[model samples]
Target: MAGSAHGDIPLTTISFSQRPNGTVATVTVSNPRKLNSLNTTVLDAFLSCVPPLAQRSDLRCVIVTGGLCSVGQQAFIGGADISEMKDFSNAEAGRTFINKLHLACKALRNLPVPVIARVNGHALGGGLVVMASADLRIATSDARFGMPEVQRGVPSTIEAAMLPAQIGAARARRLLLLGDTISAQEAESWGLVDKVVQADQLDEAVEEWVDRLLKNGPRALRIQKKLFAMWEQVPLREAIEAGVWEFGTPFEAEGFEAEGRRMMNEFQMQNRQRKSRL
Candidate 1:
């Protein structure tokens, strides 16, 4: 894929490759000196990178993670770059800074395919908010998560507000109020992360999810993801009605109908052959 960085920000990178006959794009955050902090530059790079990837019809999934670090290092993203925040002397400056981060997060969430967060280490404050924006997250056992923005004298905002829908209001409140980090296990239990694996298995877990997603019909997956986003915005009854309408959409679309029938026939044929053999 074309490079993601714009201007002098060389820390962020987007690598694209074919996997299971579909495109898989990875966005790596690589500011090791600052523990992969999400500075305005990096967030700007992310915003530029993700939209093009999202628009690709062949793209199946996007994986966001920190670039490789030393064996025992800790940080997917330590947080927003404090140095950048220190100069936020006015409400407008603070809004501008946070808005940049929000745009990055929004770009990720708007991707047509699933976005998977591969959380290898620390994901604190804005880092944690970024992780929450992903459609799914798989983290290493040693990974840490928290919303410590409050500790830094700023309440978590934008995608950080997504925590209530992710891990529940009570748990989200605890993290936002206390600014305490939680282990990967606790994060999984609280529904912040979908799975936790050994550090060595982090890539394997991500690959497994990617493979699972790839196995489904692309159009169906896209529609499902869109419906998921819609559910978040609508009331329960309206959401259910929308979902039912979505369920019948494939049949209304000729290509999806043909593919679904073909798959069903293959499945029935396999079952019949097995029964006859028995």
Candidate 2:
């Protein structure tokens, strides 16, 4: 948000960009000097920034990225600013810091549209959880992942709780207890990441996901994401009922039904044309 007092350079920035069509957006965290680490300022930027993106009615997908460094380090988010936290003198301050971190992650998770984490670098500690908060993650082959807070004299908590469900308990334990970073390949095998590619191919991989998402029904995609969040929190029976209710949602009160009708008619006409050609 705000830069240094002298205005020579920005201290940290969470910048947002949208496609010309306004259906896709990118949120880039730029603190390259710190490998995009989350300081209070950076965390505050996330808190203030995500809501505006989430509220966009035209947005079908959001891609989150970590800015690249001059030295070619792919640090998505190295962690909370350890240098900034080393001076914490009170329990209240520690709690406040952690609360900010949790809120930032929750903001990403709360987006109605899919959040694709285009992780090009290290997603360690808090960064890993932020990456997890995304609906899907596409990391570079050299990306690193772990929870090294244990090494810094603190247990990994908060959204670190999500690791077990994402990567299974054994793998999650290996990360938290051992404080060792895993390669992107290992992370993909463990189900922590959806896909991994070379640094040069990272943008292509992300665009592929975005293009695929754009082909689907926009309203259905949003409803599906909402149901996904519901399914994660509720019992199987309730989740099923929620889906049942949503099954007829597009055809119900809102103008979403018009989209459904239009697409169905287009598909049927295309199918008829194909049959006649045969």
- The global Cα lDDT (0 to 1) of model 2 is 0.83
Which residue runs of candidate 2 sit more than 4 Å off their true CA positions? 1-21, 70-72, 253-257
lDDT of 2 by residue, 1-278 (tens): 33422222213344444555447767766667777788887777677778677787988888887866545576888888898889999988989999899998998989999999999899989889899999999999998998999999989988999889888999899999999889999999999999999999998999988888888888889999999999889999999999999987777645534667767777999999999999
Q: Pick the candidate with the highest lDDT.
A: 1
Alpha-carbon lDDT, every model = 0.84, 0.83
TM-score, every prediction = 0.92, 0.91
Give residue 121's error in model 2 in angstroms.
Answer: 0.9
Q: What TM-score does model 2 achieve against the real structure?
A: 0.91
Q: What lDDT tens digits, residue by residue, belong to model 1 across residues 33-102?
A: 6778888777777777778887798998899998755435768888899998998899999899999989
Clashes counted in candidate 2 amount to: 1
